[model samples]
Target: MNTADKPNPAQPHSLSANDMNDKLSGDPISNVLLARWIMRTHFEQFAGSSVADIARAYIGVYSNRPTSWQAVLARNHNMDKSEALRAEDDPELVRIPGMRRSKFLIPKSMANMVFGATCLPLLDHEWRLREAELTLEDYLRIRPELIRFASGSPVRLEEIKSFLGLSGSQARACTTVATYNGVLVRAPSPNPWSNRWLYAAAPSELMHSHDALVDHEQLQWELACHYIEQYGPVSVEDLAWWMGISKKLARLFLEKAGAGEIESGLWLGPLQKKTFESWATNVSESSDERVRFLPNWDPLLMGYSPGSRHRSCLGLDQIGAYDHAGNGLPVVLIGSKAVTTWRVTAKGSQRLLSIHLPDDILQKDQQIIQEAAVMWAERIGAIYIP
Candidate 1:
């Protein structure tokens, strides 16, 4: 399990629009990622207050705290904005650096699992070590000192700097060392919206110890199962990209977990095939017309890599849903296709939303979009500027 050797990033291997149309033509499941939306409902079902359920389903969602949770729950469960916002304090969920070394809100049960599978291996690479100018011994030795002040309570980076009399770069480097080694974690934001200033705190027993022994294969296999169950009919390339691992490693995890190939280069976990087929049979063309407003970094938008995004972003090639670096943006979805991107900004004490749409959108659809946008704005205490 030595992950020292960085594998070359794989080229996109997912089916293109034409290839998918020709291959699964007229198949209900082939209806441009609509089935994925339906299949996902299978996992999105949970009590309104159960943030852990949502966290477990997506293998941890990007932690913009409750904004990300609220947008996702509003679409899937019709959850109230206040109810979703309360999830920020749900003890069942813990924030950790998960896939891609990004802060993720995950259920406590899987906190260590994700930390082991994704965060621990960070040490095996030399890049961060080189950037920090610290050797393995140096990194480990510095961890305890860096975490001691923030161990029991959340402390801001600035506070750490002032207390330690370290410069900004030195403080960041110290925290980076602590975080990469799993000693420190990004703390909850005081509010739901801004991440401009963040707190750092030591991980609870959920993450246990930085140097604790872990079963890497078991952790990775469990993650592979979760990915397939939640976002499957995915390509190895998609899995690799999502996990920020190489395709060889991704394929090895998939193979070890006995994932099944539904189409060339596309796979589902062995146990997921039957359930996926059942869900696919229930989705109809009418389902394609459903509209949803997904927040920036929603799992659906981040579920697949560049090659497989066509599943949800069909006909959106001209209007990209993600940035140049592949980070997802707030999107307006009609069925599974992204029709536009949306942004929200503070206006006085309220918020203003602007939905960016293509000129070709139909009048009727525009009306629907407006209505949906207004309703979403009301839920968030925002005004939609048409």
Candidate 2:
């Protein structure tokens, strides 16, 4: 009696392409959210000593200020009423307010984020402002002292130039680039700060690679990766438009990344226009009419264009921008389209989430929106009763 072991005779042999996609992205949070996860946990995780916190504090100072390493030394003196910057002048320096140490050394403590880690620098800079008494607007003005950034605090992304070690035309160029990447503001020169505010720090984290460092490359790569990962069995051209890459570069990059079509002989996006092809066969016909609550800078809104750049995958009408300054509303995506908008408001200790729908929302879909709003509130830890 020869008994052969069959391949898991009780279970199905293999999953189809659709099944595989569903498994990976069942509760899919787009690539943008995934990037945040990588920033906090992988690329810029606080692995080293308290030195990481030090680096973060100085990163904010240098990126937005005009002072030099030497000037910083002088400022240290001025801060201590000059005379001298003895080790103990601040033996009680108290770790720059960003930390709780009373005997922290400025230079040694400021190394974790200065080297290679990208987000570390940003996290530190933002936190430092939390300790300041100025408003973001005051910090960026000609006189930070006059601005009252302390109405409760310092300006964050808008004043990133206070960090770099650059000057002249190069400084201006850096300011522009930083602004584009979501750095709030850029100053031409520095005053009490320093002139090192022109260049960019490492972006969110160690982005994917290659073009990731380049201007639009990382965003482009992200767009492509997102499309394929979420809606694969698609084409390269479909990705290119979503990514805003040149057709030629898009093709080259896709090929370089070693992506292949499960279906042969055709691509989408930039290449499809020339060859007349589509990735229809790979998509699932049954898409949920679920209303997803998304942030203002959500990946789809940022990447996809109304032009023929991308396939009309989602029907978004009037994409609403969520205010970073204000507690914003969640954009309502009915099915795969952005139909209307809604937001939750807080009055005193009570909170209210509101929605404005265009078409008649079904009883079930409305329930989804309501539950989603509740979940959103819970994530933000609001004390809403109903």
Candidate 3:
């Protein structure tokens, strides 16, 4: 049976090296190029860079991972330990509840604008759909107590739930509303190595003072252009998923941004001709022997709709790299395709990097892959054991 005839019409065609390279010569194909583009386009800062620079680049790192700061720093080759340490105390960079009520590190200067542009619309839509029993006025009634509890410190969500006598779901909704309205900000996780984030009273003085509002339509247009420029050849569905907006809104934003379709379900912004030409030339000259070990939740994988463009790059088996909860895991990529899963394990005093290849891999390819894994391990300060 032809695999192309599968139910998922977006499934990638299995191509020979030359055929893949031909496609790449005109568009993105390799995850390495995609990952490098993301790093260069969004997070290119010099060593010892200020938190302001970090925030200005791509607004902020999504930071849903444990050791979120470390992950961000690690991806940037220029950042050093001192810079990372200094960034921890930089008042300009503030943590906040953002996209889908998840934690994000945003610039305090643009916090209100970012919230207005992204989170508020989502919150409003969610409220309209659910219409929870707790009202905004009800949340305000207990605001002073909540603020007092979190002032000068961080407080966990559970603590707030207990104090307010709210169920988990209720507390979550209330916090989402509170954060959207600038009543609260996400504090640094007490344990940076864990996913346990805390909430604190919004810095009213700073947040309120900088209510510099941009035209909402203009902001959405700008955002749409940014997404396409960074991850184009993307579809409306991809944009909607990435921006947490509906398909109608995504299409409107793209249209306002002057995006044109490169092909069905793939688009490029108005000024992307030079970029497209450059990438095509680069792809034409590139070697197919490259490999990379990408981290869990890397934007290269997360930037597009998981099963659509992602499946085209890595194939259907890539679904196994995600947990049951839909969280992505670290992966091993040969060219654009994810051929295996990988993880680092602690052994004695050193970290051992293990590569788990798919059973279909030939012995010759396995040897080459093992060698590439060793290189990856060395790059990441791990010991490779094939």
Candidate 4:
């Protein structure tokens, strides 16, 4: 085996590195290259770092998506010392002290708010009338209420609620920081997917009183980069599917990164060309994919939902748990494919993980797969320790 093929010492690609850089035309901003740039731009901050921890940052910062309390903490705790995953780690979050699970969500209100704050890392949000669904700019241009400062003056929760016509429960949810303890109400008109929240750095991001900070375009750019860089060699359809956005917006954003034309039907932006070299050599090695066990909301699973070009990649197994009606379970990742199924059972001190790998896997693959499973379970603080 080649030295690089040994156990992926470097941080795993946040998305699908297997296919990030491919041929394209007209514009250099092909989905493959853009996704690689996303991963390369962001994960480089934590290169060779723990894949799980890095994933947390990508989901919170780049994706700008709100996460469930359970989801955020689990990812944080996937590493051995989850309790220590964050200074705020707690027993409830961790399966064991310092061991927890993490979930993430990206809300609509915060998306625009994050863009306005200039706190998001890169990319700019171009406000178009159609995009925001507001034909009259001035009508939607109302500024945030004038906030006065006075010594010993505390923030009146009700005042904020009255401004937005929110209920007491909704107010509590907005105040929730790291651990999701409240239910932020969904916006009724412009954005109905509102109210929901995802994970973020507690002290730094979530605490910000404003909603716009969550969906800022820089974060979106970062997310776009993650999808392409990590899951590149992909297509526009994949990004559209993963993000739940329209293809027009996806193409528009990809083009913004200065993509350039390559061959007659191919385009390669500066970043895309750069990505081509990084994984060019790795392709042959990846030709024969392996069996991987991915938790629910896996990047691949979540990326290609309906309205996506590669909609089928996620498969039924990864989504069953996320059914709008009930709690979803983890999925069995087979190479780039989402195949088979799995469930975790906790009998007091021990957690039993039963995985049903794809029937298609060969005996040789199965043997190798079991090894990865042990490694994965132990990594996520599985009580049975594989």
Candidate 5:
């Protein structure tokens, strides 16, 4: 990912007293309500939905998790392992290089626009830094070769490297540039259950085609708005960090999107303020105890500013749940707060969910946690061993 120097601080937008009371309350927001809103909105927990629905909702989902597809299917469509594996072959969901240069599964309909919006901006700079000798001419020369090779079938990265007879650095630069240029894409993994993937030409015969080049500024504005809508009460720094752009660019996009600052350093998009107000009302009235077993790299955990929203949910004492790189471990979340780090351990033929809570659980809460764990384990073919 390309990093930029921090820009000057944005002047805080003022909120009226009535606006503050209605949208920005003095009490701390419960992580549960926030989590539910994110899961229901971003993850699309509605029944009878499909993989295309998931892709369309978030533009794309980060597919770095071991069972990323299963997690998406289970959360979004309530699919079990066999069902998710079958759905993986659906032609509408296409994998490509996306935000932060990670693998993402997007709807085939929006692949080109997404590439134009997210990947192109960083490609030239990233490639140049990786291989200073590489140039546009080099990319132009290699484009046809890559398309020809990948046209027959999905090709492995090693195969492309060997066929091109280029050094490792050169191969990486070429592949990245090609992907951003829309000539190629990192194809979906053949096995939905695993993360092993192949490189293939973009606009695969199976993909739904659309050739319009989305306006870069418009896309950036939309991206900023979507982030705020899904992860609002955010800051310019939060949007900048999440989009992997400079803070200056983030501020520009936010302003273009007409996002308002609900409080100092806290921003909300035009549509989100009403949503937040409604959620606040629900939070006050509801006393439901919600538990969820979120997979590693789950967007709910990754979507917000790392130290800001993440810290509030996990608390200072549970800082150990995250690694030095800020990748949050799979967690057992009780009412939006991560109570324990959870993992699946193989025990002979059975996979068992191991819960690692930081503090002792009350007997009643433990029973509730156990039930939710078991339900999640069953969906992924695992047993809860809480």
Candidate 6:
């Protein structure tokens, strides 16, 4: 990779490496970078914490599936899947369409801000209907009936479709519209791995909060700042891609949020500077070598600009851990650098866990990797295959 594409301050793109090295001599830039993100994501920051606690820290937990969300909670709080995966019972959490119009599990308290920022526009202007013959007028007309159907109890999507006497594209379109307008929400799936979910009327409080119609510009700016707080030291391109907005709009939001350029291209929000300093100091003080097994579509892997994703992969840029569509696959991290990839597959009544490692890895490092892999497998009732 070109030096310009790298996020490491030790290997400056313009200034001589020595000059950049000197500039960050007091505290190593690499350490600061890793520490800042780890702290921000709250990776292993606590033990035995509830799902609601961790949900509050992130803007949204990408709901690829219940298993993916479980992996996030398991890794963050150092708990078993049994505990982490069962948080579907948490009343404070709810699923809604978030960035890029994708489903996300977020705190109910954040419903107004997130829905206004990402989904509200879809209600009238940009209906994401796939093939339904329904118009916006039809959607608005059906919204109340859908909410009334879902008001009494959580209803499965299929059940909602049956009651509406809609099928295929029509059912999908109506449900999508209802969800974006906060008339419906995704309830927990019946099983951890199922793609299907129960739909329910959104909480009355959440609906009322959004009905107030917070100023659009203010909501966007607030969401941008929230992203920076959770994933800062980012660029305009990163913010744009993450929020699925135009670069011009992203720049405007950053400016409005008082984001200062921390480097040539990277910026940090004014509100996060103190927290960033504390994280850097704490990381520098401990600086321990720890290993983390990250799950597919983890935010850390998906949070950066395409050009700057090397920040997390470091020497393993060619690992091809992400699919062509930019969705992250499961990975293994030593500190912030993803050194390898891993996966588990069903084998008879058991699951086989496999780790892809460089042939030249040192024996000690190999042993450490094995130990971590074994612990991860046992946590999920899988058998590690060395």
Highest-TM-score candidate: 1
RMSD of 4: 11.6
Candidate 1 lDDT over residue span 191-263, tens digit each:
6676743455654576653455667767777787788777777788999988888899899988887888766
Q: Write model 3 residue lDDT over 288-329, tens digit each, in one string.
A: 334455667655556667566544545424437777765567
Q: In candidate 4, what residue range of length 10 has the lowest lDDT sum? A: 91-100
Alpha-carbon error at 245 in model 5, in Å?
1.8
Worst 10 residues of 1 by lDDT: 1-10
- Candidate closer to the true structure by lDDT (higher is better), 5 or 6: 6
What is the RMSD of candidate 3? 8.0
Compose the digit string of candidate 6's lDDT tens values, residues 269-302.
8877666666544443332345666677676676
Query: How well does each candidate superpose onto the true structure, as a TM-score?
Result: 0.82, 0.36, 0.69, 0.48, 0.76, 0.82
In order of TM-score, best first, we have 1, 6, 5, 3, 4, 2
lDDT comparing candidate 4 with the true structure: 0.38
Instruction: Quote model 5's TM-score.
Output: 0.76
Clashes of each: 0, 43, 1, 60, 0, 0
Q: What lDDT does the true structure give each of the candidates?
A: 0.66, 0.34, 0.60, 0.38, 0.62, 0.67
Candidates ranked by lDDT: 6, 1, 5, 3, 4, 2
lDDT of 4 by residue, 56-102 (tens): 43343222111122233323323233432342232111110000112
Candidate 6 ranges beyond 4 A from true positions: 1-49, 123-130, 207-213, 278-286, 309-316, 346-352, 358-364
Residue ranges of candidate 3 with Cα displaced over 4 Å: 1-57, 70-74, 78-89, 120-137, 155-177, 205-216, 282-284, 288-291, 314-319, 323-326, 343-355, 362-386
- How many clashes in candidate 6? 0
The better candidate by TM-score, 1 or 2, is 1
Off by over 4 Å in 2: 1-238, 241-243, 256-291, 307-313, 317-329, 333-339, 344-352, 382-386
- List ranges where model 4 is wrong by over 4 Å: 1-47, 51-53, 56-234, 241-244, 260-269, 281-291, 305-329, 334-339, 357-360, 383-386
Error of 1 at 212 (Å): 6.7
